[model samples]
Target chain A: MRVLIMAKEGEKSEAATPPTPEAMAEYQKFNEELVKAGVVLEAGRLYPSSQSKRVQFNGKKRTVIDGPFTETKELVAGYWLWQVRSIDEALEWLKRAPYDGGTFEVREVIEFEGM
Target chain B: MHRAIEAIWRIESARLIAGLARVVGDIGTAEELAQDALVAALEQWPTEGVPERAGAWLMGTAKHRAFDLIRRRKTLDHKHEEIGRSVERAQESVDLDAAIDEEVGDDLLGLIFMACHPVLSKDARVALTLRVLGGLTTEEIARAFLVPVSTISQRIVRAKRTLAEAHVRFEVPGGAERIARLSSVLEVIYLIFNEGYSATAGHDWIRPALCEEALRLGRILAELAPAEPEIHGVVALMEIQASRLVARVGPSGEPVLLLDQDRARWDRLLIRRGLKALERAERLGGALGPYALQAAIAACHARATTASETDWPRIVALYDAVAQLAPSPIVELNRAVAVGMAFGPAAGLELVDALVAEPSLKSYHLLPAVRGDLLRKLGRSEEAGDEFERAASLTENVRERELLERRAAECAAQGTAG
Candidate 1:
C-alpha cells in the first residue's frame, strides 16, 4: 500500500523562523533513510503557507485566495509519498523520523485504473 | 512437431524473453519478439531440423527481431540510439554454441523483479510472473487458479502496459530497494507453492505441477541471491515441504494427515537439499527470519524417523521465534499445535479456545479443525464432532472436507461406543 504522510504544523510557527542548519541536516538524514528503505517515492517540504495559493470553484465562479490563511495547526509543513507493506510498517518507519515535536498523519493513496 | 516446439519453448522462453527484454527495454515487446521467434522455430525446425543449441537459437532470433523493431521505430532518434547500442551489444555476444550462459541467470533475475514489481496489483503480479518467469500459458494459469482465460490474459496485458507506462526499470534494483522488491517476488512464489501444496477448492488434494514450478523458481532465486539468507530460508522451507508431497495424499487422492503420512514415501533427496539450504541460511544470518524459523521447524520434523519421535519441543521453539518475527493468528495456531504436542492436549486446547473470538480465525477452517483434534484427545467427543462438522462446512477443498467429515464421523462413533 502507498501512503501520503503529512507533517502537521506545531506551535513554533515554521513560517516565522527559518530552519537551523542542524535541523536541516537531521531532516536530510531522515530523508536519506526513507530513500534507502525504498519507501519514499517522493518527499518535500512546503515553503510555509505564506507562499501557497488556493482557487475555489463555487458553482463555476472562481474565487481566488492566497495563503498565510489563519489556521496554523491545520497547516501542513511537509509531506512524503511512501510505498509500504502496511500502515503499521509505514508507522514504524515514521516513528523514527528525527523531528523533536510534531505530528504526522498517514493516509493511504488511492490508486485507480491507469494510475 | 508442436509438442517438441512446446518442450523447447518451456525450457527456453523465460531466458529468451528476458534477454529480449534486456535488449528492447520493454517486456511487452520482448514477449512479442520471443513469440515471433517461437513462430519462426515452428516454421523452420520441422523441415530444417531442430538446432543443437535451441535456447541460443531462440535468443538469437528474438534479439534480431528486437533490432528490427528498434529500426522500424526510427521516429524517436534518441530511443533508437539508446536501444540500438544495447541491441548491438546483445548481437555481439549472440553465439549459438554457448546456448545457456551466465548472463541468462542475471537476465532471468531481472525478469523476475520486473514481473513482480509493486506497481502491479497482486493478481496481476502473479499472473504475469507465472506467464513470463514460470513459462506458463494463459490457459494453463487460468486452469490452475480456476479463473477465466480472458481474465488471465487481460491481467497479463494490463500488467505489461502498467510496467511500460510506469517506466519501471528493466534492471534489478540495488541495495534496500532490491530487498523490498525481493519480498514481493518471494511472496508470489510462496503463494504459488501454497496453492499447489494445498489446492483451495479443486478436487485434487495437490497440484504437483505448480509446486514444481514454484520450487524451480525458488531454487533459481537461491542461486541468484545467495547472500540473502531469507532466499535460502524460503528455498529450504519449500524443499522440505515438497519432500512430503508424495506422502500427502492416498492412492485415491484422499487427504493424509502429516503424522499419519508414510515417512518411507518422503523424498529423501529433497529432505537433504532442504537441510543444506537451512544450513546456508544459518551461515549467512544475523538471526533466523520467519522463513528460516519455519524451515527449522520443518527440519526438526524431517530429522525424526517416526511421527512419535519428532522433536516437538524444538519445533515449538522455532514456532515461538517465527511468531516473534512475523506474528499472525495462523502462526499462533500452528504454535498452538506444537505446544499441544510438546505439552499436552489441554494446553493446546487453551490456546485454540483463546483464538475462537479472533475475527480473522472465525472463518478459517484450520482453527476449528485444530480445536476438534484437541477436543477429541480430551475425550470431549460430542464437542469434537461439532468442531469437525464446522471445519468441514468451512473448508472449500473437497478432499479436505471429506477428511474433516470422516473425523466428525469418528468422533460420533467413539461417543456412541463409550
Candidate 2:
C-alpha cells in the first residue's frame, strides 16, 4: 500500500528551522533504513508555508492566496511517499523517523486504474 | 482436453491472477480466484469447444469468481456495500477484450514487481516468480532448481502470506523506486537464465525450460517498460545467450565451450532479435550500462563467422567499460579473460594471477579454470593440469567437472608428449 506521510507544522515552530547536525544525522540513518527496505518511494521537506502559494477556483472566478497564512498549525512541513505493506507497517517505520515535535498524518494514496 | 486446458492456463494464468489481484487487492485471493476460473475452464471449455478469446474468457470467469468471493465473505460486513457497488459496476462495464488488451500489460508489470518485492528472501522471490509470473507449477520450479517440490511449495506459500500480511500493493512504483525494483526483477530473471545456461549442481549442463521461461519474462518486461534501456539490454543479453543454447551442450550433454560450439547450430532468429534489442538500448543514449555493455560484447561474438573472426579487441573494450561501471571482482575476472583474448596468454595470466589472492574469488571455480586455459596456452602443461584438476574439484556441475577433468588429462598428455 502506498501512503503519504505528512509532517504537520508544529504550533511553536519558527519559520523553517532546520534540525540540529546530530538530529540530521539521525534522520539520514532513518532515510537509509527506509531506502534499504525499499519502502520509501519518494520523500521531501517543504519550505515554510511562507514561501508557498495557493490558487482557489470559485466557479469561474480565480483567487490567488500567498503563503504565511494564519493557519500555521495545519501547514505541512514535509511529506513522504512510502510503499509499505500496510498502514500499521508504515506507522512502525514512522515511529523510528527522527523528529523533534510534529504530528504526522498517514493517508493511503487511492491508486487509479493502470497506475 | 485436460492437456489443452493446462496449456491455456499456463499462458493465461499470470495475467489472470494479476488482473484479479488488481480488483481484489490481495494476490492470494486473486490466485485462488484464478484457479477457480481454471477449474471452470476445464469443465466448460472442452464441452463448449473452447472460447474464441481464451485469455479474455479466463479473465472474465476469474473476475466473476472474485465478485462471488467478496459476496460470500461474512467478515467484510462494512466493506460489503462499497465492494458490491464497485463489483456491480465492474461487471456491467467490463469489456473482456478491452480489459485483456489494455490492463494485462500494467497488471503483469505489477505482478512482476510484487513477486520480486525486497521483503521476501531471494529463494522465496525465485520460487514466487516462477510460480506466479513464469506460470510454472511448484513441482516444475523445484525440478528446475533441483529442490524438493515441498520446499518450493512452502517457499511460495510463505511468500504469498508475507505479501498479504505486509499488504504489498499491486502497482509498479515510479522514479528511483521503479529503478530499484527493476534491478531486482532483472536480477531474478538473470539468475533464472544463469541457472539454465549453466546448471550449478545438476547432472545436466543446462535446463532449457528455465532459460525459455526467463527469456519469456525478459521479453515481457521489455514490452512493459519499453522506455527503460536496461530492460532491453537484459533482454538483448538473454536472447544472444539463448541463441547459442542448441550448440552449448554436446550430443551426450557435456558442456561445450563457446569457441568449440558449431556456429551453424546457433539460432539466427534469436541473434537478430538480440542485436535489434541492443540497438534499442544504444539508441536510448548515455554511456552503455553494465548489461548493455555485456550485450555489446555478446554482439561481437554473434557477428563473428568463426572463432578466429571474433573481434577480441572490441570485446576487451566493452569489458573494460563494464568493469568501470560495475567494479566487482567477477567483472574484473571477466575483464581478465577478455584482456587475454585481445592481448596474449601472458597478459591474461598476469591479470588472472593478480586476482588469485583476492578473497572473494578464492573458491570460485572459474578463476582457476581461466588460469588453466592461460597456462595451457603458455605451454605450462604441469601447472595447467594442476589448475584444471583444482577447478574440477571445486565445480559442482557434473558436466563442468567432467569437462575440467578432461582438460586436465589433456594437459597431462601434452606434458608427457613434450
Candidate 3:
C-alpha cells in the first residue's frame, strides 16, 4: 500500500528559519534508516505556504489568490510518499522520525486497480 | 480482524523472527516463537488496541516464548545452558537504543544470507527467501508462482532442513566469502523479479506484487551493502525494468515491446529512483559489473523521451561491454538487436543469422522472433512470415504465441501485396 505522510507545521513556522547543517544531517540519518527498511518512495519539504498560490473556480470563472494565507494550521510543511505494508507500519516508521514534536498525518493513496 | 492481523504479521514477521533468532540459535524454533507471537496478537489486538510498536511487541512476545522453550530444553539437555548464556548476552546488548537498532539490522542481514545460502537449490533459494525475508506466506508464494501450496511448503521445509544439516552459519560472511554469497542472493532476487516481470508460463503476464516484493528486497539489500556497486546496479536495473511494467503489457495482458510501449505510462518515480541508483553505482565503480552495464543500457531507453530519440549506438556500446563480460549467446542476441537499431536491419539480420547454427540458440524462440523482426524491416516479408510462424510454434505463452502469429499474418499480407 502507498501512503502520503504529511508533516504539519509546528507552533514555530517551518518558514521561520533556514535549517542548520546539523539538523539536515539528523534528518538525513533518519531518512537513511527508512531507506534501509525499504519503505521510503519519496520525501520533500515544501517551501512554505508563503511561496505558494491558490486558484479558485466558480462556474468556469477563475480567481487567483495570493499566498500568506491565514489558515496556517491547515498547511503541510513537508511530506513523504511511502510504500509500506500497512498504515500501522507507516505509523511505526513515523514514530522514529527526527522531527521535534511535529504533528503528522498518514493517508493512504487509492491506487488504480489492475491485473 | 484476522486480515489486519495477518497484514501486520506480514510486515513484522521477518524482524520478529530475526529478533527471536538472536536469542534462540535455531531458525525453526525462532519462527515458531514468532508465529506464537502472531497468534497472541490476533487474539488480543482488537480488544486491546494494536501496540504502538507492533513489531517490538511481537519481538517481546516471541522472546518470552523463546525463554520458555529454552527453559524446557535445559531440563532435557545440557547444551541449552550455552544458548541461555548467549540469550543473556543478547539481552545485555540491547541496553542502548543504538545497539538495539544495530542488532536488528545485523540480524536481518543474517536472516537474508541464511535464507539465500548457496547450499539450497535455485527453486529452494527463491522459496526460502520469499518465505523468510519477503515475509510471504506459502499460499501467497504458491499462487504467485502458479505452483501448489504444498510444493512451496515442501520447498521451504526442505530448504530449512538442508540449511540445518549443512550447519550453515546464520551470519553474513565477511571478506571474499561475503562477495561470493552476495551474487547468489542477487541472482535469486532477480529471478523472482523476472518471474513476475515476464511470466514464463503463467496466465497473467505481469504480477506487480512479486515485482514490488523483489524491489523492496533489492532496495533493502542495497541499503545493507552500500559499498557494493553491484547491489545498486541490480537495484537500478530492477527499478528501471519495473518502471515500464505498467506500459509493458496491454489492457488485456498481451506483452508490449519496448519501442511500442507508451512512454507516458512509465512510472516516473521509479525511473527517477532507477537513475539515482545508477548514478550511485557509477560513482562507486571500479569497472562496470554485468548488472551495472545492463542498468546503463536500460537507462539509455529510459532517458529517451520517445523511442525514436533513443541513443541506440550507446546502447550497442554498452551491450558490447556486457558481451565482453558475460560471453553468452543471449548477450550476443541482445547486442544483435541493438546493432540492428543502431545501424540497420541488414546488419542486425547478419548477426542474427550467424547465431542460427548455435547449439544454444537452436530451441530459443527469440532467435526466430528477432530474425523475423529484422527480415520484416528489410522487406523480405515472405521469409519474415515463415520466421514468425516458427517463433509462434516454439512459444508456450498463449498471448505471446497469438502475437507472433498475428505478426506472421501481417507479414504474409505484406508479402502478397508485393
DockQ top scorer: 3
Output the worst ten-in-a-row residue range by lDDT, candidate 1 chain B. Answer: B199-208
For A1-115, candidate 2 gives per-residue lDDT tens digits of 4689988857634365677799879889788656534456568887876787899999999999987778767778788887644576576567667776878899998742111
Q: What does candidate 2's lDDT look like per residue over B84-161, in tens digits? A: 664665565465567456767788889999999988888898889988877778877888888898999889899999
Q: Which stretches of candidate 1 lie over 4 Å from their true place?
A: A1-115, B77-102, B200-206, B416-418
Best candidate (score: lDDT): 3
Assess the local accuracy of residue B32 in candidate 1 as a C-alpha lDDT between 0 and 100.
93
Arrange candidates by lDDT, descending.
3, 1, 2
Please give fnat for model 3: 0.39
lDDT of 1 at B417: 97
Error of 3 at B118 (Å): 0.7
For candidate 1, lDDT tens digit of each residue in B346-376? Answer: 9999998899999998899999999999999
After superposing candidate 2, which stretches have Cα over 4 Å from the reference? Answer: A1-115, B71-100, B200-206
Instruction: Flag the better candidate by DockQ, 1 or 3.
Output: 3
